[model samples]
Target: MRSPASLVLLALPFTLAVPAPAAGNLGSATTQNGLTAGGCKAMTVIFARGTTEQGNVGSLSGPPWFAAMSKAVGAQNLAVQGVDYPADIPGFLAGGDKKGSAKMAQLVMQAMTACPDTAVVMGGYSQGAQLVHNAAAMLPADMAAKVSSAVLFGDPMNGKPVAGVPAGKTKVICHQGDLICAGTSTILMPHLTYSQNAGEAAQFAATAAGM
Candidate 1:
């Protein structure tokens, strides 16, 4: 059998012919660089991807920001885990296909359990940004308090009232014209890009994680 990523390609052509499913699952798929061999605990950065994006929580190309942030995080000797979830259009509106928000809470709990002293810095883009907020809100107070920082870009719920990390620890970055967070859907261009702010975001996260 082919890999799940490859299988997506086989199903792509038919996706247009037939309706697509809600992309994938609500599992905690983490991609990191510097974890010690026997799961030694280290400072951690958790990233969540936007709609339709695949692989790790962050992409390596197109928008270089994610990759840039990954590089910076590695420089800090911290591990990065890109979270996985159903980020499809429908799934996002329906609050994820298998309780994506709930799974993220569990993911956080598991991470803390596995690496007790690990400092967690998290972020997400677009729909993934919304996921970050939802996940943060769902976590138990003690667990949520352990999170060092949360950075969100183009979150649909940016300006709205939502549960999330503490105000001081949370940073919401919305471009002037990005309507998703700004509530202006008429313009579709600005919402598609955010590479310029990736480095600054990474730096902030690194500092918050004490790296």
Candidate 2:
């Protein structure tokens, strides 16, 4: 059997396509390396893609959010890094991928340590949102508090706090019909439409991150 990413290639029912690199900010590359490239910027966005999604940042959410954030914070001032993980359904069923969540947390601290002046934002979609919650719990309060903000779309853990992150600094955008936001595994139309909320989430992140 093939993975969901591959399955998406065979079927178009899910509409997994994201917004084409969010207006060329990412070009055609599906992966990102701003955090580990020995480069620092005004802000760092560590985003995790949804389960069964393509690349590290799924086209359905992360890219759109990145586009909005780029406009809000200025592309030159922003850096994006997508979390690497299996993004398989099994991981989502397991309450997010363990290794992925750990990596996200590490990236957060790494961003802070590497760029003391740069703002750090944790973000994700679908199971990726679950990873955001898990990653927040893995960090110490002091370190977590240092994180500038968090933005989650089509969240599986909606209405739940993002551990040590201040409620005011975190944004969770869930559509009313999105079953995943309601804490269920069922994927609904609302969940697939999170890209529409990208601007709103990005604006909130910009304010929270002091952009």
Once superposed on the true structure, which residue ranges of model 1 sit more than 4 Å away at CA? 1-41, 58-66, 70-76, 95-98, 160-164, 184-187
Residue-level lDDT for 146 in candidate 1: 89
Per-prediction TM-score: 0.72, 0.89
Residue-level lDDT tens digits of model 1 in 1-211: 1133422443234323422223222122223332322353456656666656655453411134444555666634555555657666555454333466666667677778888888776667766776777888788888888888888877767765335466767777777776556642222446655666777877777677766
lDDT of 2 by residue, 1-211 (tens): 3244532443245745443343234534456777887489999999998887777787888777888888888989888998999987778878899999999999999999889999999999988999999999999989999989999998888889999999999888989988778776667577888878888988998998767
Where is model 2 poorest over a 10-residue stretch in terms of lDDT?
A: 2-11
Best by lDDT: 2
Poorest stretch of ten by lDDT in candidate 1: 19-28
Q: What lDDT is obtained when candidate 1 is compared to the true structure?
A: 0.59
For model 2 the local lDDT of residue 38 reads 45
- Scored by CA lDDT, what does every candidate get? 0.59, 0.83
